[model samples]
Target chain A: MDVIRPGSLQDCLRILKTEHTIPIAGGTDLMVNLALNKISPDRIIDITGLQELKEISLSDNFLKIGALVTFSRLAGKEIAQYPCCNALREAAEKMGSPQIRNRATIGGNLVTGSSAGDGSVAILALDAQVELTGLDGIRKVPLSLFYSGYHQTAIHSDELLTAVYIPIRPGTSSFQKVGKRNALAIAVASLAIYSYIRDSHFEQIYIAIGSVAPTPIRAVKTDLFLQGQKITSGVIKEAARIIQDEIAPITDIRGTADYRRKLIANLLADQLQQLSESKN
Target chain B: MLSCKINGEEIHSEIPSDMRLIDFLREEMNLTGVKEGCSEGECGACTVLFNGDPVNSCIMLAIQAEGAEITTIEGIAKDGKLSDLQQAFIDHGAVQCGFCTPGMILAAQALLDKNPHPAEAEIRHAISGNLCRCTGYQAIVDAILAVSQRK
Candidate 1:
């Protein structure tokens, strides 16, 4: 139950590597896990107070989101710049409740690597990259490769996730999801679709779905099929079928795998129709 | 050891390292307004404003609150005068059993402080964390909105 408040990232890594430490950002997830007796670490590194880790900036090619940036901060009008990211914004807006969003962080959500994490699916759809800092220095990794499996991440105990980078995409995006209820609810099945249109045809399509797989997964088969294809009911149905086949949903308290598959098909078709209608 | 400001008073207590903020406020400070509905983060009954941000005190460690300013329901009124928001809650009949009111008030206060002119949707979003089984939340939202609409 040791609580260590390191003044800098370097010091944090030093103390973390020297002991059985867990970095706590917002403590939205870590606190709950600790209370449930699920995780026991000798030292808890409090990173929530680190000012350097709380910044939100944008570069020429990418948007950099600090590891400690709360969902409430990201939901601000300033950071929500792109259309696909709009879905991410909407998801952020619906995460937990206002209190939860104020404390729960983007880094915590990504680090938890839960398939049901609403923000995880949204960021995954944006093709975000994560920055890691340690004794060696800073290095970045694509977010897709960050999570190795359920409740697991490539992030080591000696490293700290500093920022998340999202490259700007050209297109309008929408997120449609079905949860048990409205607020503080995990998605039974959710879909994020970002498609760029060129002369009524999809030049590029980015689709990811969550709560239906071990991790938030992109509908790669559907994405490839939709690319360069005209928006039509037939194309949407075909892509929907491809998504149902691609994702490996499991039976959880939320819903059954068969139900989730059906949900994916319906949500994909609905969002694609919405994209088509919004075009005019 | 935890040292921080709670309810406008500087606190320095050698509490158990694993004591959560909710327990610290209730047992040490005797500020029982922060009720614990769910020990987990799902229920917002134990919500408190830490550094002007609404968070679940139940899920956070007491030591994690060190060096931070916390606002509880007891801190809402000054000089024995109930805040307009608190009065509005009474006026709108927002409390039934009165367990969730303190947290509800703090959550509403945090929202009003940030956005004084929040829309209806925003009002709902602000108190989404605080669960109210008695009022069904319409009265709660009305109370917050009524107070916010006042000047």
Candidate 2:
């Protein structure tokens, strides 16, 4: 196997456009698969050295996180202290362990396209936009449309994920994960909720779930049911029922399909009740 | 060929591009103090200080450390004398099987480097990745707390 360390983003783009290589940022996930012989790419492009992808800046309309920003940075006080990005911070802090977080990048986590990824679930709830850059140009795709299937994404072979843009919206957000252990365990089922409540009603809401589907997905039916609805136990219970039907979970080593369905419904109901009480 | 500062020494060698950092440390540099229990990032047995931050070396390519400073278990002691944290490990009987000691100490060291006087919860959080099946973690936690209190 050959490895190429590109010094700049332009150089990386050029290499990515011309070569048959796998771009490795943190290598927390990729290296594991490589060692297990699950993937055998002939060339590997080390993208961790790209300075442009290591930034986290708040713009007027969005909080732009660079692609190579490690989970440790997101879990740190610098990013976690931000009210708008707190759910994402919670997800980052709960993933793996300190060592894994230090080497795991948000970009890598999304690109892996794992349904068990906590970061992807939170990003989906945030209604974030992914920035993909190639030799031709750049395109921003919504997180909802980014996943095509299990372990597959809309990212092209020649394009590099440049940044993730999360809208700067004032909302109450929460992240909950049911992993086997507190640290270093893949989530059995996870949910992230971001809601904009006004006058004790849900003005806008987004809910994303993981490990209960082929890919981390938004609970579109549940979100639509809750939008513009009154903050009441009856409405919350109805929305929870809608969420149970929205997911297509599978029985795996982590959890059973029936258990996940029940967990999702209960988790969503609890989060909705909490949000309602707090906002009211 | 890559160049990196290991154990406070600037070393340049022709390491394989595909070699994991843990293998490079143990095989090429003879730094066997960095254990390879899991070979994956889960166990944290291969934990080392990469640019003053603890990371699982087994999951990292040796080429990735080209320009970074790496500190393995061998780097913690100075001039054949164990650091205060390492001495405390022995004093508290934190090394039962001794396999997880190096990684635990390095993990704790990374935490202390950032926060010298860490709380008990912080110490446990710092070494959460390094699992010691023998000592049940009380001794390890006590060892780290002792070092912090002494400082």
Candidate 3:
């Protein structure tokens, strides 16, 4: 096997264009895949030296995140306290142990496209967009349509995900994951909610769930049903039922499909009730 | 070739592109403190301080350590003396099987270095990656708190 440490983002793109090389960022996911023989690349491009792709900044009402930024940075003091980063921060803080978080990058998690990835589940609710760069040019794709299937994404083999952008919107966002244990446990089901309450009613709602489908998906039917609806116990019940009914959760060792539906319905109801009672 | 500072010493070595940092440290460098529990990131027995932050070396390539400052269990001592944190573990009976001691000490050291004083929850969170099946963790937490109280 051969590895080339590209000095810059331009160099990485150039290498990707001419060679069948896989890019390695944090290597938190890629290394595992390599060890499992899931993917064996003759040439691997180490992009860790590309310092330009390791920034997190707020620009034009969007929280722009570089693809190489690690989970530890996301859960740092400043981002954790940032109002626009609530859901993302929460997900980072809860996703993995310190050792893993210190090395795992947000881009690796999204590119891995795990159905139960906590970080991706939270980003899905934030209504984010990702910038993929290639020799041809750069393309910005909304994350909602980025995933084509389980562990599958629209990122071309020749393209590198350069950065991620999350629009800073008004109101609050939250994330929670249910699993057998906290550390080193994959989520049985996870939920992320972003919403605004106006005059005791729901204005805009984005509900994203993970480990309950082929990919982390937004609850389209549930979101449409809850828009402009008053927050009440009856409404919460209906919303829970809709989310539980619409998702296609699977039965695995972590949890049964039926158990996942029941747990997620309860999770959605709990989050809605919190939003209803919050002073925001 | 990887050129970096290890335990305050400048070092250079030739390694394969796919060679893991843990393998290099143990086999090539003869620093056996970095243990491999689960080759995956789930188990933190191979935890090492990459620029003072705890990271599992098993999942990281030696190529990634280019110009990086790494601290393994061997680096925790000062002037051939075990640091106060290591002594605290012994005094508090925090070690039984000793498999997880090095990683736990490094993880705790990272937290205490940052905070100088950490709450019980923070201590727990710091070593959450290093799993200790020998001690029930009460003693380990006590050992860390003992070190913290000294400051």
Candidate 4:
């Protein structure tokens, strides 16, 4: 395979538009595919050279993270300072390993569309939007609506995921994942919650789940149920019940369908319990 | 052609840039110290320093390192003297079959370069990527901690 290191974003877009070349960043997932003979491309465009997509900036309380920003940066101390970044940062910390995090990119994670991907699920809970840049122009897609099916995304072959925009809101967020082991294990199930809790009641809440569906999904019913509800053990249990039915987990090597459903409920309860206890 | 620095030496190669960084450093440049136990990234046997950060060289393209500095196992010793890390690995019995020693040392080196004095947990977390089939991680962690303690 031939590799083209595009000097500019526009140049990369032009090549992607004109040729059947595949765009690669980090190459963590793509390399695995290559090793397994899953994808054999004639030409590959290394978009890592596009420096514009490697920055993280905040303006007007909205954080724009470049697509090439590795997980190491997202989970690093610098990003942990952002109040709205807690969930994303937590997810980055739980992802793969130090070596894998050093190379994996948020853009690559979204495009790979693993239901259990740390970055995607965490960003989903934060109600983030992905920026897709193509030869025509750039358009934003709500991360919730980005995935079409298992291992599939809305990104066109000619388009590249340039950046992710996260709305910075004042709240506490947390992410949890159940894997075989603490490090270097794919998630059996994971959950992330972002909320503004006052007097043990949720003012606003967003919940997202992964590894239980074909795509990482927003826990809409559970979120709506928990919103404005008093944070008690009873309410937490009810929300857990609501989420078990809302998610569509499968029996995979990582976990059984029943086990995943059980995990979601427990994860939700554990996170909500923390908030309730903190109020005491 | 790709121009870059490997093990403190400036070099250029016209070989296909699509080759894995591990293959480029080993087959093309003869830097076999960058092991390739698992072509996939699951095993840390192919870890190397990419611009000072440890990464799975097996998963990276040689073209990706066109202008970046790379450090492999060969880069650890300077002027034929064993780096402190290498000496610690030996003193602590961190080596067994030795297949994982190179990757382990490089991964530990990257961690030390970033945080010279790492806690035991930090040392374990840093080397979590590099797995020694010998399952002698306690010694490896001890060796890394010893080096950190010495400094």
Candidate 5:
């Protein structure tokens, strides 16, 4: 095995163009797999040294988070104070444990494409765009479109995810997850909701559900049903029903299919109710 | 070969690119203080200070630690005297079975380093990763809190 530590992003991109390299950020996920011999690549690209990809900046109505930004950074007070970043911050805080969060990067979590990944669910709700850089060029793909299948992403083998861009807007967001244990446990079902409201009506709403589908997915049907609708117990109950029908949950070691579906609905309804109550 | 500052010592050694940092530390460098409870990232028994931040060494590659500053449990004491935090642990009877002490101490140290006066909730959140099947966590939390109060 060979490891190449690229000093600059350009050097890393150049290496990716020619070598069959696997780019590792914090090595929280990849290193575990490598240790178990689950994955073996000819060359490994250590991109952690590339300071260019470790930034978190907000500019031009967009919050740009570099791929190397760790979960610990996202959970910091500076990022958590923003309303637009509430769901992301909550997800980051709830993920893994302190040690794992210190080393796990948002890019690694999204690139893993796990339906139960807390970051994936929150980012999907935020309707974020992922910036993929390759030898060809740079392309921004919506988070919803980035996942091709389970544990797979639209990112080409040679392409590296550089940054995630989220449109910053004044919205109330909530993230909720039900796991077997409070700390260091995978979510049985998770939900994230972000809404822009005017008066008592929702101007726009984005809902993402995780651990109930093959990938972290936006509840488009439910969102459309609730958009521009007044916040009421009736509307919220109906929306919960729609969400239950929208998600395709499966039974796993963490939970049963029926249990996950019900959990998602309850979580969504509870979040919407809280958002409504907080608005008034 | 990789060159890294381990426990304040700048050392160079031929380490495999795929070897986990915990394995390299225990096998190559003979630092068994970093225990391996769960090879997966779920257990924080292998926690270490990577560049002043606590991280699980079991899930990090040795190559990834190249040029990084790491502080293990052995590095906590100086001149054969235990640090205030370690001494507090013993005084508070925080050690039980002693399996999780190293990682727990390191995690608590990381917290106290950043916030000298962390609230009870903050201290609990800081060591949420480190699991101790023995102490039920009351004494460990008390030990860390005592250190914070002393300072």
Candidate 6:
């Protein structure tokens, strides 16, 4: 394998397009696939050393995460202020093991484009955006529109994912996921719900579920049912039904489609109840 | 070819681009304390502190170590004396077959260095990356907690 360590972002892009290389950051996902002969590339550009792609900063409305920021760094003091993605922080804390989380990256997670990837679901639920850089220039795309299908993303072969932008929610948000075990386990089904409560009712709601569809999906139908509705067990039951109907999960080694549906229903009910019980 | 500081020593070597950090440490540097249990990064037998953060050495390539500081179990003890964490592990019977001992100690060291007074849950999370089939992990957690409290 040919390895190139470029000093600058421009140099990195130049090498990427000229050598037709696959970029390596963290290598938590890419290395495994490469070792298993899933992908064979002539050159690998190591961007884990690039300082520009290792940042997580916040602005008035957005939280910008660098591509090379590992899950360890993401779960550190820097991003802890936004409790809106608590489930994401918990998921990151639970992903792989401490070692894997220390090395695996948020950008690599998105670029890998696995349906069961933990960070991808929360990013989608928070309505994150992807920043891509290539020979043409830089552009940001909504993460919801980033994935085209299973193990697929809109990232061009020549483009490198530089950052993920998540909008800060004005109100409370929660995330819930059920896996085989509490540690180093992939989710059977994960749910992230964000909503606004005013006058003791859910005024607005946004729901996203993972590992139960071709990609991380926003439960638009379920959200529609919950919006403007009081936070009640009866309403939660109805919303859970809509979520079960909206998701199209497939049978896999981890779990069956039927189990995923049931898990989603239960997770939705649980998260809604928790949100209702919260002081905020 | 890769160049980096390993265990307080600056070194350069010509290695295959795809060679893992664990292989580099064990085969090239002859630091056998870093073990390779699961090449898929599941087990932390190959755990190492890269730039002060604990990471699975098996999945990281040797080339990724360019210009980085790496600490393996070989570096845990300084000047022929075992680190406090290692002594605590020994006193607490955290070692069964001793295969996971190095990784566990290095992982715990990384944790303590970051947060000297980690709680029980934090200690568990710190070593969660390391897998030991021998001792059921209670002794390991106890050893780490004991060392942290002593500090």
List, for all models, the DockQ compared with the true complex.
0.74, 0.88, 0.87, 0.86, 0.77, 0.79
CA lDDT of every candidate: 0.86, 0.90, 0.89, 0.90, 0.90, 0.86
Write model 3 residue lDDT over A1-280, tens digit each, in one string: 7889988788888888765589898888888889999988888999988888898888898888999898988887757655656888989999889988988889988999999999999999989999999988999999999999989999999999989999987778999999888887789999999887778777788989999999999999999999999988899999999998898888989999999999999999998888877754
lDDT by residue for model 6 over A1-280, one digit each (tens)? 7877898989889888865589999998888888899988999998987898888788977888899988887777777788776656766766778888888999999988877788888778777899999989999999889999888899988899999988877676777788887777888888887787888777777888889877778889888888788877788789888889998899999999999999999999998888878834
Give the docking tier of candidate 2: high
Candidate 2 residue A14 Cα shift, in angstroms, is 2.2
> Which tens-of-lDDT digit does each residue in A93-202 have in candidate 1?
77887778888889999999988788888888788899988898888999778878888888987888889998876876667779888888889998887778989999
Q: For candidate 2, what is the TM-score?
A: 0.97
- Residue B104, candidate 5: C-alpha displacement in angstroms: 0.3
Of 3 and 5, the candidate ahead on TM-score is 3
Residues forming the 10-long window of minimal summed lDDT in candidate 1 chain A: A78-87
Q: What does DockQ come to for candidate 5?
A: 0.77
- Candidate 2's residue-wise lDDT over A1-280, tens digit each? 8888988888888888755678998998999899899998888889988888999888797989999999999888767656667779999989999999999999999999999899999989998999999989999999999999989999999999999999987876788999888889899999999988887778999999999988999998888998998878899889888999888899988889999999999889888888877875
Instruction: Residues B52-136, candidate 4: write the lDDT tens digits.
Output: 9899999999989988999998898999999999999899888988888888998899989889998899988988888787847
Ordering by DockQ: 2, 3, 4, 6, 5, 1
State in Å the error of residue A62, model 4. 0.9
TM-score of each: 0.95, 0.97, 0.98, 0.98, 0.97, 0.96
Which one wins by TM-score: 1 or 6? 6
Clashing residue pairs for model 4: none
Q: How well is candidate 1 docked (DockQ)?
A: 0.74
Model 4 segments more than 4 A misplaced: none
- Report how large a share of the reference interface contacts model 2 reproduces: 0.86
**Pairs with steric clashes in candidate 3:** none
Candidate 2 segments whose C-alpha is farther than 4 A from its true place: none
